[model samples]
Target: MTLSFFQKFWSVLANDIMAVISSFFHLGQLLTAINHTFISLIPKIPNPSLVSHYRPISLCNTLYKQILDNVMIAHDYLHFLNGKHKGNNRLMAIKLDMSKAYDKIE
Candidate 1:
């Protein structure tokens, strides 16, 4: 049976929608299966292996230094806010004006 143009179009659209819905359902089932598998495996495993094996001592030291510096800066800012640098009234009145707010003249 030959389908009219509109009928063919509707049929194609319906098929595409069904395909998307089926794939979405399949994805949900896949996620559920994965969760179940992980849950079942957790208790049976004696030792869990760490997948991320990159451990650099020098990198760690650098990160520690950066964290320390940031903490010190934050502490200094807190101290300043709490009247530690209240005598520097000139620094407080310094106005910073953005040249181009949002317009780029160039």
Candidate 2:
């Protein structure tokens, strides 16, 4: 059965399982930078000229993130909410310290 344009879009977004997070370029484009995030240098202190006094701000597309975020929120709520995991034996989590991680990388 053939699906309409809106129907296809709805299905794609509603059932987005995050299988493919990739993007491609169209004709005549040498490179496609759709996932390129906007980086901004933000000052940590009031005012300073030192490079170490600033932090990098990453701004990316939120449209796709919201889809994954909704799924994660639901999963976490079911696993951690009030009395949700009372009988669970163990809890597992991974924490990554991103603070100052990009300072010397650049």
Candidate 3:
């Protein structure tokens, strides 16, 4: 039995949604880790000058890393789906022509 176009589309959409949700959960864990690390550093830093400058930089680095990691994971997921479907030889062709299809009279 073969699935119809709508079926295939829905299946792919579900997979994509699951991937995104998983990514979000991973990001949340990463944020928690970063927060914990920052909290741990708070007591060690005796000088206010050092804490003020370094905290922002550390948070920025953590954010940048998470964004980059999520993007790469999404890219890989897309590539994996593309490769999975590449083996199936399928062609979809559509042609639409609208000539004198609408008329208005006043």
For residues 1-106, write the lDDT of model 1, one tens digit per residue: 1124325677666776467557768875322331221111222234546533322211122212344576698677666766745555523332344454432222
How does model 3 score by TM-score?
0.24
lDDT of 3 at 33: 42
Question: What TM-score, computed on C-alpha atoms, does each candidate reach?
Answer: 0.20, 0.36, 0.24
Shift in Å, residue 83, candidate 1: 0.7
Q: What is the C-alpha lDDT of each candidate?
A: 0.43, 0.54, 0.46
Question: Per-candidate RMSD vs. true structure?
Answer: 22.3, 11.6, 24.0
lDDT of 3 by residue, 14-101 (tens): 6764675577787753334433322223333555666553333122333234545866986876666666645467434333442355
Which structure is stronger by TM-score: 1 or 2?
Answer: 2
Clashes of 1: 0
Show model 1 residue runs off by greater than 4 Å.
1-65, 84-106
Models sorted by lDDT, best on top: 2, 3, 1
10 residues in a row with least lDDT, candidate 3:
55-64
